[model samples]
Target: MNEHYNRWLHHRGLDPDLMQELLLLSQDEIEDCFYRHLDFGTAGMRGLLGPGINRMNLYTVRRVTEGLARTLIAQGDDTRKRGVAIAYDSRRFSPEFGAEAAGTLASHSVRVYLYPSLRPTPMLSYAVRHLGAAAGIMITASHNPASYNGYKVYGSDGAQMPPHRVDKILQALAGIDELALPSHSLQDGIASGWIKEIGSEVDTAYYNHVLSLSHENNATANQQLKVIFTPLHGTGNRPVRHILGELGFTQVHTVSAQETPDPDFPTVSAPNPEEHDVFTLALTEAEQYTADIVIGTDPDADRLGLYARNPAGNYTAFNGNQIGALLLHYTLERKAAKGELSSQGIVLKSIVTSEMGRSIASSFGVKMEDTLTGFKYIAEKVDRYEALNTPFLFGYEESYGYLLGSFVRDKDAIQAAMMCCEMAAYYKQAQNLTLTEVLEILYQQHGAYIESIFSFTFQGKKGLEKMSTLMDTLRNQPLKQIADLPIAQVKDYRLGIDHLPKANVLKYLCTDNSWVAIRPSGTEPKIKFYISAVADIIDAAQEKKKRMEKDLRDRLETSL
Candidate 1:
């Protein structure tokens, strides 16, 4: 069977290097590599960057773009003419992939706006709307390991292209039965005026908008604040530093080792900001500089990592929920204090995010809404509110993704970093408190709510099957109790309630103020358990969370 696939791929014109490797792989390795096409869902295609149909290589990139091309063509001449915008991160072959996509679109007579160099994901979202294009493509695997790459699609609205639209693109992808298709050369496309490179103009606009999000225009506070930032060797170096420096953040320091655009991400085990260890170097710099705050963005610059000084003068790290709650509280308090907060103000969060921010919003009389676990859903709500002429104050997910302004339809870490700086300044200068102190204040006001996510990764084809079976068992035969806590409610998102799209997710609410949610990750091969616990005291909340996690994990292990 492996030999059959090897011959088939060689005949289909796969790259010679990849074909050579296919012939050398062990039988089991070949089976794993050729067992299936990398599944392209709402997150687009993401996988290891290597040979085989299951990987993210030139062939798969072109194949996905070809699908997008056919989808756009079917939408009529106007849509095709509006064309697609392409941007890539600082990953291996990212530039080449962007060019391949642009060339593929250009082959179909579609216009293309290609970024000259690596840029962040949110900028691609901004470019889609800024360029008036019908679609956008970002070549990034977000904060995944250096070995992975991805292709993310966006609609004209700047969000990840919604599900209904993705279905059409998938249909187009299914129709392409062969990889050896004639295509236009990148140079020819550029010469023909169909492929355009965009830079500085969009960067300027993005920087200007990010700067404008600093409502607390206390130049003295900003100048006085000490900050340390790292881009984790991805695409955020230039823009993040430029925006901060231009905004009067005079005392800024960066981790020199991780400042350059190196796809290998030599400094960290993973480029993801969510992991505690990714901040090792940044934390070192923070201590050396005695910085008031530390910030790091993932490879694509859409997700942000934050650390701040506590009352004890010790730097403390915050999880995504804590960051979101802080930003939400800061934005609301400042807006309401200045009487700038609208009467129709609303805040959005993913279903899996902590509910602490929800309580904070209520205290400020702002509506708090929950979408499924994706920034795109949050953006969808933002778009609806924009159409309704209502106010969108904030949107965030627990995965370090956040959006503060409507200027960009996806999570903007640049915006988050700016606001976090300003918020830290506000609490320090005006309120005489640190971020940790402000968080304590919020906790006091709304009871202590703690949230954590545990992920179990299963590799290879059998691992995928194991994950699927786990979700199936949970959904088909629901849990009646966990840790002797009675179930208060069960929300099966697959049924699609509360005006949200259907998804394969299960949430079990306990009688106590705690809950557990189970779902497969959209972009990776892992089953994530979202657990949240609340109590009148911080220690009690932490204890409850630990207990819930232990009981549930133990039960899951026994069942397996």
Candidate 2:
């Protein structure tokens, strides 16, 4: 660790700000930052921006870009010409990091279509497919705090690159041993046409596609629904509002303080839509105007979070599973009503998502499938469905991610925002129902299902070790029962059951249709516990979930 730290400390021509940052870090911080080179994990590369081998900074960014450039070059000239599309969110250093990536790719004679200004991750996915690019680069940390940043690579299909392809990129990245490599300046790349600037044309195209998803008769609901939206000071403001406006949604209200892009994300603690705290400002604004829905999207706009007014006139925040169920039901209902539903159509979700989604799909005679636990897996499934000539009706996860149309392969808040408003409006005008009421009806019809999430974060080296031990213990010394419920089955993903790839995940199926899944987060330093409870009623489900969680905590809490 000291040697790694000294290498950067003494390296000539180091970034000046980085050098100052290096000089000030405490001993523990130094060790934390210098212990290892940042590698591509389940997600793409991400970390706090700083001057360390493991940290996120210009040097690390360039190294990864150079690795990507080499990997692209190896794929042959045709792929290189197809280029890479680059987009960024409103995180600090996002633009600089994006420009640097473009310049790096250009330096290798690879073509680049770089967004002129900040845009969301879904736009990058769309740009990749629309331009027929070989791959795409999204410079963002998603919903992470302002101090962190990330670089995610997408395949030509416009999804996060699968693990096998990412493995090649990592191998190429690991082989890079020097920093003094050929590089082109942003100006040089732009002037030489190696890196072309892209905007309005693509934005207009995207807005049009999302708008096209709206049903013709839904215009009345779109106009009558009063909606409040907050981007949480990221990239969703312009495109989200633009689509809503184009759909005749004139009553949309934007939180003025968060309407513009601010890298600092001053209004929220972490800029994550999943957290209720992030919606504080939007909910406040919703109450002032008596808005029907309060919507919030994260930094890169790939995920969405929402709250809707209930029958009693109080706003309620809905978790990811509830929202996913609602969206799945709404889309299928609209399709069935229009005679657009297909017997071969299927809905995709992560393995850990609520089973209620499957019930919704089954009721409509649509198939529902589960992937491991990432949007990339869902994306892969969508590609397969296309090959088999089946339409993908919808895809979602326990996280606030939903994909309606296949145009943009990754999870898209842009689509979620529009459909959410359309759904709320349609129900409001036709059924005289609030989203809360509709949700209850679905629950009552499709067995009351409840899901609870437990995340224990383990930071740094020791934390990683602890997580490994915990996973190993649970895998080897498996529990046979929980809360006095017999465990019907146990799935250890490390052995790659269910024809899926090997992953460090464990799932327990109980006799009463309840289940629990334990796995470490691919993107963050945390282990997540997903408990899904199913029963004939909400109270029964809640009680079972409470007892199961308590039992699990009793058995495992001491280890941590």
Candidate 3:
């Protein structure tokens, strides 16, 4: 018997059912589950829910909250009094885990303002700042599979707790010796005013702010434009539809099958909108309605996907980079036309996002800045630029995440949906062009830019070791060329540059301006390779991207 496994099984405070389940785990499962505690990366602790320290269960949630509580306590009584805001998405046990976190913080004498039901992540950020809370906790795995759940911590600034604060939280977590300690009673906290349930007030305020971001206030008056939206059984349903309905969008139709919040996500294999396959039900519905455009939000409602009717009259999906480029063009073009474009206006994208946005921003005389791969970094820029008295026009990552307004500190699918819909309505009504057509014009003007991401999932201990070894090999022995393209520049983010924190990421720019980035996903058990290709013609760019993908796969196979 592994000592760690037995220690957990024999712990007196362990849940009896969980202990029995652990007792029955196969040898390999036991090792996989008990080998080590789940690593709390920059994002927070996320893993499969099961009976082990490595999984996301009540105990792990409590431990993380305990760390957060300790960090807040150290910040002083005022910080603790300001408390933390808590919200959850439509995942199994999400509410239970959220309540557990609230109890844990209350046990530490810290106040908690928790959403009464499932809510999107951005609302948690808004609530944190709006309610003057010291921190926020969102219980979600974002777009990960249903088997996974997560706990993401946000700073008082409503961004993901920055690296320095994350370090302090980790320091406090290290001091926690007991993993299965029960938290205080949530009911007791509520009765004593230490835990407050927040609902309609926050929702109304968030809805109003998102509505204010719309450039076309009367966009809903375009009753002729057919629109279809789906929330994929997550938290986006109410807020997204509510905003659209209030905006007077007369022809909005939500995918009825996916409107209800279901943790099982019964209709789709994965709830991620990035995967076109997940939009099967929505597409079918769109075709029936001959919808002008189709929009869908992921499980947490943070990432959005757009499907538009192509020249061939079929619903074609847009990649994250393509979506970002289209939105950037629409926003900047409209703002410039309205004389709202600021001299100090800027757009922010992650390092791996498509350069097409940069081209669009430059055409409008707006500066484009690159941050590390997460939205947290983008949010940091938003906060910084606001303080500097510059306008943050828009921000997006290549993973289908976008933010248009500073009202929310995280990627907001609700806001993206509103803006994308408004843009579509404007183009159709005024320019006599569909969004896809506008995208083609942008591509023609900027040259064709194609981007693709390839990820290799490594599930268990061996997989993790392989991923580490692969990163190490890439870092130590860099590739000079990919498919005969000469490497022009190599940027190793780990060494740090431009005031950004050190990260395990590598990017190689080719002589032809094409680039490929290699990094392990901070939140998932996969190593991701991001490839971007540019050519005068779209066909040429597509061919180059396919060749690059093939070459990358071959190299990874050999290296691993």
On the 0 to 100 scale, the lDDT of residue 294 in model 3 is 96
lDDT of 1 by residue, 102-207 (tens): 9989988899999998999999999999899999999999998999999999999999987888888878887464356555578988998999989789988878
lDDT of 3 by residue, 1-560 (tens): 77778778778888787787887899989888978888866467788988887888888888888888999999899999999999999998899999999998998889999899899998898999899999999999988889989999999889997787788988888857555566677898898889998978888998889988877776434666788999999999988888888877789999999999999999888799999888898999999999999999988899999998876789878999999999898888888889999968989999999999999999999999999988899999899999999998999999999999898899999999888888888888887888889888998999999999989999878889999998888878999899978899999999997677888999999999999999999888999999999999899999999999999999888766
- Model 2 stretches astray by more than 4 angstroms: none
lDDT, candidate 2, equals 0.90
C-alpha-based local distance difference test score of model 1: 0.88
lDDT (C-alpha) at residue 139 in model 3: 97
Which sections of candidate 3 miss by over 4 Å? 219-221
Question: Candidate 2 residues 366-418, lDDT tens each?
Answer: 89988988899999999999999999899999999999999999999999999
Clashing pairs for predicted structure model 1, backbone only: none
lDDT (C-alpha, whole model) for all candidates: 0.88, 0.90, 0.89
Q: What are the root-mean-square deviations of the candidates from the true structure over C-alphas?
A: 1.4, 1.2, 1.3
| CA RMSD (A), model 3 | 1.3
Q: What TM-score does model 1 achieve against the real structure?
A: 0.98
